[model samples]
Target chain A: MNVVDLIKSYGSKTVVKEVSFTVPKGKVLSLIGPNGAGKSTVMGMISRLIARDAGVIDFEGQDLTKWKSKELAKHLAILTQHNNVQMKLTVRELVAFGRFPYSGSRLTPEDNEMVDKAIAYMELQEYQDQYIDELSGGQRQRAYIAMVIAQDTEYVLLDEPTNNLDIYHATNLMRIARRLCDELGKTVILVLHEINYAAFYSDYICAFKNGRIAKFGPVEEVITKETLSEIYKVDFEIMNIGGKPLTIYY
Target chain B: MNRAKMHRRNVTRLALLAVMVLVAVVFYLLVNSHPEKPKLFQYILSLRLPTLLCMIIACISIGAATLIFQSIVNNRIVTPALLGMNSIYSFLHTAAVFVLGTGSTLFLNANLAFAVDLLTMGVVGTLIYWYLFKKTGHNVLYIMLIGTVLSSLFGSVQSAMIRVMDPNEYDALLGSLVADFNNINGEIILFATIMLLVLAFVLRRELGLLDVITMGRNQAINLGVDYDNVIRKLLFGVVLCMAVATATIGPVSFLGLIVANMSRQIFKTYKHSHLMVGASLMGMLALIGGQMISQHLFHFTVPVSTFVTIAGGIYFLYLLLFKKGAY
Candidate 1:
């Protein structure tokens, strides 16, 4: 996916301005930045959850805007943070909704197989019959990720999938993102707050600052102390951990 | 709940509602029949059949419309009546009587007035929904608020017109305003049935999207549902159904609320197909049962809406107090 000069503004205050980057296929890419730095906005634009004011997004050699919504959903799936489904849905039922784009409320055997596989992937088989409202925060988040996995898209965009999760579940979620890229051969884009998790899990890092791409490169290149300090406006010290650059900011 | 358990429960609930509707229909038709006088009984059956048909059509229209409306708005408490259809209905009737006078053809001809009411309410409701949704960027709260405001505006205008109107004309207007199954015209019932069936055929595809819509807009869009297009079409369908029901039997505000909420409570599922069927069945039972009481018990002295309002008002209060988060 190639994003060229994407711009978005909310009532004259531009949130994403002239941002340009290309995502590598079959790899995990993380967008990490300070609050209000337009990381989520860029992700939202790529997922078509929010409209772009001025830009060209070339996805698989076609303009993103020209792609029909239903058609695009086959190739891309997105999971935002606040999924407040007010209905009384079981975890299986919620996951089954992922096949709606394909079968539209009528699930074939193959669709049910996919749903079962997604639930198994997320280790949510025990809770498949439980109501979503009755689950814990971490369990519910896993249920949502299971739903997205059932979608079986080539590109998956997660906007802060770890929000409100504890350290154990957060780490688990990051590992799942890695497996999504490595095992499933899917391209993953994430908007993350914890720079450490991004540096650890993602193959590529695109740092944002004040609505612009501050740096876009491999994790080793973008996680350097100088780049980290410059993008986040803080002092940073980098340490090599298992050949990966980790940041310590003060 | 497990899938099998929930499915079984839904089936049981639906069967119960079906039986209730059947019992209501039987009592409505043959409760006080004079079997000894075969000719009189036949004559009474003829009178009751049209009224029963009218009630059934109105129930289906209101039930399905309310379920769809709640799904679109993603709220269980609010009904399609909040869209100001009822107010528009009352306003049109009062304006017709006040401006055209009771002696006018619009008032004298029941079919003509019914046609006018259905057309005006459908068009105006669609326009209001379209304009408000576009202007507010699909903010449902704003649309509902404006609907409430418009309802009060029309209500005040209607009352003002009523205050200065002649007593005889007011009497004429009163019969049309409150729900009355006693004086239903067979032709209007036939027209409403045809219109509803046509609407059902036209909106079948969109209706399938209602399950995803209950998850809200962003999720619906993410699931590859054409959010805006589907919503616009479904809301239009809702307006048409509301218009037909109100024009056919006048406004039975509480019937939709009662049946829809009861269906949701009983079924406890997110699928609109199940909910719609359950709601329509419950609506049939409520209206038929209420009509039976109004006819035999009250001797047609009380309108059916009175019983429905009292029952529905109590249920609404119960929902508000105890079942706040259940929906």
Candidate 2:
């Protein structure tokens, strides 16, 4: 999809301004920025979970606004920032909601299998019946991710999937995001605060500053000390460990 | 879902439904055997059948309606009572007398009163949901405030009318103020039953959407469900069903909270199909059981309204506590 200068405002207060980027069809693009840097806002607008005040989003060389919402949902799925689901559903039942576009109310056997697979993929096999509200923080976040992953879309947009998760589960989540691109050929776009994880697991890093793209390209280009210092305003030392750049700013 | 567990849950759900129906039917039989009700199906059908039908319909409709409503509101502790539907109902009855004068109210037909109440409340509810949620950028607080204000205005008008009416007529109106099976709207009962069944069926397709919705509106919309459209559709069904039930049974406000809470505890899931059916059955059981106690045991000739309110009131307190502690 090609996006040109995307901007979103809430009652005249601009949240995301003149953001421009192009997401390749089969790449993992990670957006790493400080909190309230319009990362989630950009994600929301791109996924059409919220409206944009300015800019154009084109999918498959067509305008995004022209596409019907259901059609858009088929192509892209979003795991939003607000992950508090008030429903008392189990992991499996919650995951089944991903197939709502294809299967309205009734759960066909095939849909059932997909839900099972999504649960298993999240490594939540044993806790499928456990109430999601009763699950641990990491487990619940994985459960939400599993639901979006089960949507079976070409592009998956996640806002802070690692939020509220422990180190192990957080790494596990980024690894899964990588696998979505490498194995399943689905384009994964995520907003993560931890820059090192983005540099480690992502094919590309898209940097945003004050609501616009500071830099957008390969991980090698975006993770450099010059760009990192420019974006974060912190003195950073970059080290290449296992061929991937790692930034340390204390 | 595994075959074994799925079968087990289905069996348990079926058993629960059967028990609820049994409670309703058995109590209904006892209530029908009263001195005022004649023997034989057709003879008893006049007074008791209508009462049975109205009670069952009101109980089920409001019960299931509140289940969906609470899910939409995303708070199990809040029911339609929080929406101020009940107080709005009393306001309508009292205002009609005060505004149109005693002559018109005295000559007013029972069915007509119910019809007017249903129509006016229906319009108000639709307007409230639309204006607050749709036009003003989906604000729930605005909706609640408007409803509360309208409820208070209606209540004050009704109270003033009561002070002016003849003491005997005032007593009669007050007596009918609280719902009882004795003063059943038989014609509207059939209408309500048909409306309940139809809405329930239509809402059945909406159950899965509701399950998705209970995940919260933003998540539901992200998953491809048209969140606003779906909410409007469900709320319309909710308003219609609640209005008919309330008008028919004379406002058993908190009955819904009790039944919805009971169902959730028994079967722990957010699936609307299970929640709706379960709550409806439980409501029927509670209504029937309460009526049985009032008739056979107390012989108090008192309306079953107090039992529903008191029981539901106590249950509401328990739910508030549950929300405070329970996850």
Candidate 3:
């Protein structure tokens, strides 16, 4: 997927300005930035949840806008940071919603198989029949991810998937995300606030500072002390942890 | 959360279904019963049959409209009444009486009057929703606020007109204002039934979409459902249902909120198929049950609307107290 000179503005204030990047297939790309730095906005635009003011997104040599939304659903799927559903649905039922584009809620044997596979993948089998509202924060987050995974899209985008998770759950989510790219050969894009997680699990990092891409490259090029301090306006010291760059900022 | 618990929930749904069927049977028997029995059965059938049909129409409209509206907005607390459709309806009723006089052809001809009501309310209803969308960018709270204000404005204007009209005319208008199945014209019931059927057929294909919509806008879009187009179509369906019902039977405000929430609690599912069916059954039961109580227990001294309000008001309060934060 390639985006060229993307621009998004709300009223007189421009949120994303002239951003360009390409996401290689079968790799994990992390978007790291501060709050209001346009990471989520860019993710939304790419997912077509938000319209772009200008630019082109080329997916499979076709303009993104030209692809029908249903067709796009088969290839690309997105999960926003805030997943608020006010309906009373159990975990199994919620995961089956991911099959809507394929069967429109009439679950075939294949759809049910995928739903069960996703439920087992997220290790949510115990909570599969539980109402989403009755689950803990971490469990609820996993249920949503399971829904996205069941969608079986080749390109997946998640915005801040670990907002309210504990350390163990957060690391578990990142590991699962890494396996989605490595074992499944699916391209993954994510917006992350934890620089350490971005450096640890991501193959590519795109750092945004003040609504513009400060730098975009491999993890080694984008997570250095100089780039980290300049983008975040914080003092940073880098340490080699398990042969990966980990930032120490106080 | 377990198989046993799931079984219990299913049992509750089955029990509710049984109760609805029992209530429907009782409603049919009661409507068919007459004091003269063998002699007056035909006379009673002529009168009560249309009234029964009218009751069905009201149930489908109010029940289906409220459930669909709440699902689209993803709020269990609010109904389409918040769109001020009921207020505009009352305004049209009062304005018709004041302008055409109670004895005039416009006021006395049920067919002409229903057409005027349906057309005016349908056009005005569409305009209000369109205006709200354009002005507020589909902000739920903003549209609700405007609807509340418009309701009060229509109420004040209607009261002012009623005050100036002849007392006899006001009395007749008052009878029309409070929803009662006894007074509905047979032609209007037939018309409403046809309209509701057409709407049902038109919306048959999109029934599952309502469930998707309850997942919120972003998720619905990501699932490949055309959010804006579906919403607009559903809004039109809502307006049509509300308009036809309001035109036939006067506005019953709390009934929808009461029954919709009850359906959700009983069904324990997000699927609109079950929710709509459950709510519609509850609506029919409430209207018929309330009518029976008012007719037999109170000897017709109290109106059915009074019974519905008292019962629905209590249920609303109970839900608010116990399930405060679900919305």
Candidate that would win on DockQ? 1
Q: Lowest lDDT 10-mer window, candidate 3 chain A?
A: A79-88
Considering only N, C-alpha and C atoms within 3 Å, which residue pairs clash in candidate 2? none
The local lDDT score (0 to 100) that residue A101 gets in candidate 2 is 78
How many residue pairs clash per model? Answer: 0, 0, 0
Number of the top candidate by TM-score? 1
True contacts kept of each: 0.74, 0.63, 0.74
* Candidates arranged by TM-score, highest first: 1, 3, 2
Write candidate 1's Cα lDDT for B218-273 as tens digits.
78888898888888888888888887787667778788989888888788899887
Which of the CAPRI classes, incorrect, acceptable, medium or high, describes model 1? medium
Pairs that collide, model 3: none
DockQ scores of the candidates: 0.69, 0.54, 0.63
Question: What fraction of the native alpha-carbon contacts across the interface, defined at 8 angstroms, is recovered by model 1?
Answer: 0.74
Q: How good is chain A of candidate 1, measured by TM-score?
A: 0.98
lDDT for predicted candidate 2 compared with the true structure: 0.77
**For candidate 3, what is the TM-score?**
0.91
